[model samples]
Structure formats: C-alpha cells, structure tokens
Target: MAQPPSPHVERPGPAEVRDPLVLTELKRAGVWAGVVLAVLGVIYLAEPLLLIIGGLIFAVLLDGGARLIGRALPIPRGVRLVLVIFLCLGFFGWLFWYAGTTFAGQFEALRQTVEAQGAKLLGWAHTHGLVDEDRPQMVTQQLVGSVGRLTSALGSAIGVITSAVLILALGIFFASEPRLYHRGVAWMLPLRKRDFFYRLLERVGFNLRRLLFGRLLGMITEGLFTWAMLAAGGVPFAALLALITGSLAFIPNIGALISGALMVAVGFSAGTGTGVWAIIVYFAVHNIEGYVVMPYIARKTVDLAPAAVLAAQLIFGALFGFLGLLLADPILASLKVALEEWAGVDPHAEEGEEVASPE
Candidate 1:
C-alpha cells in the first residue's frame, strides 16, 4: 500500500570500518604513547628542553618590554616589539663597542688582582691557623686540582654558546606568533579544562611580566648607581664592574654575593680608601634595592620568600646548574600559582574576602 520500499542501504561492518569502542581505545592508546614519548624526550634531550624554556622566558621579556612601549606610544604591538628588540640590541652593541678595549685590560687586571688576593688570603689563613701548616702541600694540591677542574669544565663553554643561539631563535619565533601558540596550548586540554587553563596562563603571563619588569629596573638602577659611584670614587674598571653587577643581578641572592665580593676585591686592588668606598656603595645601593625596590615589586607580583627562593636555587642548581639557578624563582612562582589554584586559594583575597572564619 505504501510507496515502493526505500532502497536498502548497506552498512559497513566493524571489521570493514571502525567501531566506536575500538576508536576510543585507540585514542587512549595514542594519548598514552604521546605521554611516554614526551617524557622520554625530556629525559634524553634535557638541554633542548631547557633551551625551549629559556626561549619562552626570553619571549616573555620581549612581550613585557613591548607592552611598556605600547603604553607610552600608540603603535601596533608587533611594531613595538620589533622596536624594543632593536633598541635592546643597539644598547648591548653599544656597550660592547664602547667598552671593548677597556674590558680587555680590566679583565686582565681583575685576574691578576684575584690571584694576588687569593695568595694573600691563603697566607692570612695560614698565619691565623685556619689551615693546618702540617698539610701545606695538601692545600696546594687541592688548589691546583680545583683550578684544573674549573679549566676543564670551561671546555664545554661552547655548549653554552649553542644554547644561547637556540634560545634566541626560538624566542624570536615564539614572540612572533604568541597568540597562535597560546591557543594551541589551550586546545590541548579538555574543553572544560581549557577555560581554567586559559585563565591560569593569563595570570602566569602577568606575574612573569611583572617579575621581569622589576628585575630589569633593579638591574639598571643598581648598575648605573654603582657605575657612577665607583667612577666618581676613582675605582678602576668601574664600568666593567657595573656591567658584571647588572648581569649578575638577574640571578638573585647568590649573584649579589658574587658581584659584591668581586667589586670589593677589585676595589682593594687600588687602595684601602677605594676599597672602603666600593663596599659602602655596594651596601647602600643593594640595600635600597633589596629592601625598597624589590619588596615593593614582589608584593605586587612574585611574592616569593627569599629563603624559599634560595632553597629552590640550591635544588635546581644541583639538578640543572647555572641555568636552573637563573630560572628557579620564576619556576617556583609558577608552581605556587598552580598549587594555589589546586588548593582553591585566592592569591589576592582581602580581609573581608575570607571564605571561613571563627564565627
């Protein structure tokens, strides 16, 4: 009675095509395989992974700089980024060209002064009975052995150069298409998780940007103040010392110690008066930075405890050496952010914003 029966359509069997359960199983397997591969990759190619992280950090720095420039001038972010990069390159280039000749001489003098100081200190140690005169030969042997190890270790300095190049290239690429990469990272998470992760990334980016800004400001302030003070006080190699101090300031606690010691030693190389002035300048500038500038900035951003940072530096330094020490604070900060979110804690909660209290 009805119209002619609808034409029969052949459906493919599970074997001929695919089954839903089988597809789901396959997807799970593929995901597990990917996870395993990634773990293995990190273990085997740690240097490259570190370089990638370095590149990301560098990109963050570039992005942060561009944002500051953007606030001052109305321009496209891309153009601003390019200008910031060029400005940075120009600055470094000028620094190198400006001080190349002096740096060579100063560095040589620094080496000789360090050796002289070392001998003087050792003699003092012997006179003060800090060293067992009975084992004088042992002390010399240990010194020579340590020097040998250091020189041998420097043989791998080429690896550092390669890593720098890798970081630069990767940073430029990442900075160029940040949004694309950011979205791609979000896409890797489940739909429900993506939103939370997106917000997490936003906070991280903001914190890192702020952290780097504070760091840059502190470095410049310390370096310039140091240079002016030292130069005015007639400290030899003032510019070079300031440059080293600025570069090392990025490394936090250990860096300050090293820079301060180096500057003091260099200062003493000239005279007692110069040495005293250098020490005074170091204390004044760094105290203000450590107490005033850094505290104000950290309250606004990183908020990491100094002791905790030093501990992290120790752990990361043992695990990954110099680069780890450099990145320890940021890594710890990111970890803190993740933990707070996981624990359902509000980082910026006010007094009235407490969820629970003694009623």
Candidate 2:
C-alpha cells in the first residue's frame, strides 16, 4: 500500500559543486567595497569622531594625573580624578580672570603689528627687487589670511564651547572607569583578538602618558623662560607672547615657527634691539628643549620620525581641521605602536637587543 501515501516525500538536494571561479577575486572585491564604505563613513562622521578622539586624549591626561596623585595620596581613583578636574578648572578660571581683557587688547595689537610688519617687509622686498611691486599687496593679504586660518578650524564660539564641554564630560566618564570601556571594546572583538587588543591599549596608554608628561614639563619651562626674558628685554606684549609660545608648544615643529615669528614681530614693534633680543630668546629656549629635553623624552617614550609627524600633521589638519592637527602626532604615535604590535615586533626591542652568535 506504499505506506498509505506518506505525509512527506523526500527529494535529493543539489550536489555541492566547487565554484567555477576562485574566491580570490570575490574576496578582493569585497575588501575594496568594505574600504570604500569605511572611508565614506569616516568622512560623514568626522566631527563626532574627532570629539571622541579628543575625549580619549583628555582621558589619558586625567588618568595620568590621577596616577601621579595616587603615588602620594593613596586615595580612591575617583577622588583623585575629581581633584585633577577641579585643579584644571581652577587654573583655567584663574588664567581668564587674570588676563582676559589684557589678552584681548594684546591680540588686536599683535594682529595690527604683524600686518604692519608684513607691509614693511613687502616694501623692503620690492625696494630690493626681491618681490614684484604688483605682488606686495597680494602677499600681505595672503599673510593675513594664513594667520586667520589658524583659528578657522575652531568655527563659531558656540561650536567651540560645545566641543570642549563634550570632550571634558566624555573624558571624566572615561577616566572614572576606563577598564569598563576597554573590556566593552574587547567583548565586541573576536575572542582570539581580545587579548591582543588589550595589550595594544596598555602599550598605547604607557607611551601617551609619558609623552604628555614630557610635553607639559616643556610647556611650563618654555613659557616661564619666555616670559621672563621678554619682560626683561622690554618686548611688547611680553605676557601675551609668552602665553602664545607656551600654548603653541603643544604642537611640535610648525608651532615653534609661528610663536617665534609672532614674538619677533612684537619685539620689532618695540624696537630693533628688542627684536634682536627676541630672536635670541626664542632660539635659546627652543634649542635647549628641542636638542636636549625632547630627544630624551622621545627615547624614553615613542620616538617618531620628524618627517612622519609633520606629514601626519599636514594630512590631519587638512582632513579634519585644527583639532585634527592637534591630535595628529598622538594618533600617529598610537598607530605606530599598534602596527608594531600587530607585526609581532617589539618597537623598543631593537634598540636594546644584544647581538650574540649562537654558541
């Protein structure tokens, strides 16, 4: 009775045949598609991404402060972090309270002085036949434009304040319990890759903390020395110039040039003697920091090539704006560390390794 017309009939499935074309082309195409999408996504989300990066950097700073305090206080990390935050806020408040109006006036004077100096420079160039008469005004305008572009990345005041607030808030949250976020990130990654990711993070934190500590030390020394020398030399806007120098030192190569130029310009606004003194002071401070201090710090931490750092700065500055420019070095350093780890090569090993033949 043929099982009385069974409720189900079985049918043979199709044979599992190999692909006519190899998977190599398909895989290459998929990878290219993925890369394209990622690039588009990054461009669209540049602002938020930059803010997040800023928060991370700031968090590292707060963490460093907390760790330092812990060495002395033996207090809870949360309390230490709060103390660090309050100290920073107090310093900023003091800075604004002390110099806000003075800085404003000095900044305007600085702009006028720079423009006037540029005009005089063009005149001299023209007189010496170094610049064509027709090009002088254009050159001056370009000079002014470049100066303006320094802060153009900051956008409007409201935007600046908003970004700062977000960064600070994010930094506080991240610093309060960085491990939670670290583990969260690891959880999303493959189990096999999680350990590697954590290792990379630990290495990154170590390098970043050292790098920033060295930077802060340099900033303080440079600023104080600059202010003292300029004030003694009777240079115009000594306080303002020192502040600029100190703040800009956070940036590496390009920043030094800008601060030096501004200092010299303001010095000239006072007199030729002061201008010469300014040049001397600029070189004296920077030469010591650049040739002595920073190299030692670089060796102790991550020693990135000067050319690589400048290139990263240019690219980041172009792509993401001022915050990007500011973050470029740290980001590059982090990337270098990550890549070295991924390649299974210890970045510092080569420097200290002893070469001994097998016995």
Candidate 3:
C-alpha cells in the first residue's frame, strides 16, 4: 500500500491534447478535402478566371495607396480612385501602343537578321565542327523550329482584354467597399475570433500591398535602367525590351535571366558592336539591380525570405500553375502570419527571433 503510492499523472500540453481532435477532423473531412481539390482543379482549368483574380489581387495591392492619397488630397475618395484608374489605364494603353508600334517597325529587321544569321550560324557550326557533317542541317532546322515555337508562344496574347476588364471591375469593388469584405470575413468567425480574424486580414493585406509596391518599384527601376542602357547602346526595340523586362521582373530570378538573355540576343542581332555594348550594359545594370536595387526594395517592402518565396513559388506553381506562381508570395506571407500568430509569436518579432512553426 505505502509502496504502491498513487502514481503521479501528468496532463498533456495543449498541442498534444489537440492532436487527436485535429487528426479526427482531418479523417472525417477527406470528403471536404476532395471537394476542395475539385474546386481548385476547376479554377485551374479556367485559366482566364485565375489570371483575372490574380490581376485583381495585384490591383488591390498596388492601389491601396490611392486611399491614403484620396484622404490627404482635396478630392473625394471616389474621384481619387477614378483618377488612379484612369492614370493606370492611360499608362498601360500608352505602353501597349508604343510596344506595338516598336515591334511592328522592328519586325522586318528582326526577320531579316534571323534569316541571315540562321545560314551563318549553320556555316559557323560546320566550320567549328560543332556538328557532324551529316547532322548540321538537321540541327539547324531544329533550332529554327524551336525559335519559331518560342516566338509563336510569346506572341500569342490570351484573355488580356477580358482579364483587364475583370481586374478593373474587381479593383473598383475592392477599393469602393473594402470594409464590406472585411465585415464579411469577420462575420464568418465566432464573436471571440472575429477581432483576431480581422487583424489577420489586415496583416495579410498590408503584407500583400507592401510586396506589390516593392516589386513595382524594383521593376520600374530595372526597366528604366535597362532601357537607358539599350538606347545608349543603339539596341533595336529598346522600349519594347524594357517593357518586356519590366513585366517579367515580377517572376524573380528566372525572369531576370530570361529577359537579360533576350536583350543580349536582340543586341547580337542588331550588330556585333551593338551586341557587345548591350552585353556590357546589361551586365552592369543587372549587377546594380541585384546588389543595390533588390536589397533596398526588399527591405522597404515585405520581409519575406528569398528561400521562402522560392519555395512557395515552386509548391504553388506545381499545384496550380501560373496563377499559383503569381499568388505564391502573398499566399506564403499569409501563411507565415497565421503560423506566427498561432504559435504565439509576435508578427513584428525581430528577424533573428522569427520562428516558423509547423502548420
């Protein structure tokens, strides 16, 4: 009796106690998960919708500043919003028109260069023994075919007008009635959780807006610098190249390389001297961007880790394709905030103290 003193019992920690419930819910909601998967699958299938949603999200992030501007200015919010929208439309329209005109003017020159280079390239390959006598023609043909396919893909515009319209509509709705969405979200939660949920939404929205602004600033800088270099070096289609580079800048590492390589190729096609100059200019610009521009912009914007961003892009891109790629950072930022909050970690915790917990 005394020797068999009542064994001490220890209570499970909160997480340990919650595990079984979580597991049970997961098991019970396999059907719900399946439904979610089906819905996401359908969304992916409707690529245009996905793109429109993405564009709307981008617009919301970019135009959030319009609210502050409206408040501070003499103009009403609605008038300020209209002005921002008009400015955006006018800027993009001008870019499109300029790009179109530039491309059209350069098309014949590009075609001629490609034709001339195709023969010269094959001859050089043969002379340098890069290809066997029997394979030179086949290899050249393959190269040409590859280029043709790439050009076709790049030139094929898809749902631009429709996506623009939808994005504008969504942006207007979001700007006009953002509180409605916040209220709707808050209403979805219990009374006790509503405040927390609203805070989460606010954090998410802030992070998204910050990320967009940072990216926009970086892209503008990159595009302007690249355009200036190209123009100085007498590269054809400098404006178009800048536009393309700026657009692709949203894609991160791969985008920069692709855009830079294309610029070099365009330079090469222009002439040897021009090509050399373009290469030097681009290299210098990229170095400046990577070392100076990106770091500053990232500091000012969202404090996302590069690795986190890359990992998110990879995961989401795998799961949802292009839309997923576009939404990856925002999604990851949201998840990061949620994880931090759930783990009782401060959202504004110091960099060294930041800890990511298991989902």
Per-residue C-alpha lDDT of model 1 across residues 1-359, encoded as one tens digit per residue: 77874569676665773778988998999999999999888666755666788899888888888999989999999899899888877886787687776687778888788667666667888899998775556776787775454333123668666776778778878988998998999888788777677667777888888898888888998899999999999988888889999888887897898889888888888899999998998898789888998998888896889999999987766556566777888888888976665555666887545322111
How far off is residue 155 in model 1, in Å? 5.6
Give model 3's TM-score versus the native structure. 0.73
Model 3: colliding residue pairs: none
Clashing pairs in 2: none
lDDT string, candidate 3, 110-193, tens digits: 556656656676778888998778676787688667545433312334644655577667777777777887798678878877
Better of 2 and 3 by TM-score: 2
A best-first ranking of the candidates according to their TM-score comes to 2, 1, 3
**Which candidate leads the pack in TM-score?**
2
Deviation of model 1 at 235, angstroms: 2.3
Instruction: Give the distance in Å from residue 11's predicted Cα in candidate 1 to where it truly belongs.
Output: 26
Mark the regions of model 1 whose C-alpha exceeds 4 Å error after superposition.
1-43, 134-157, 352-359
TM per candidate comes to: 0.81, 0.90, 0.73
Candidates sorted by lDDT, descending order? 2, 1, 3
Backbone N/Cα/C clashes per model: 0, 0, 0
Residue by residue across 61-99, what tens digits does model 2's lDDT show?
A: 999999999999988988999999999778878887777
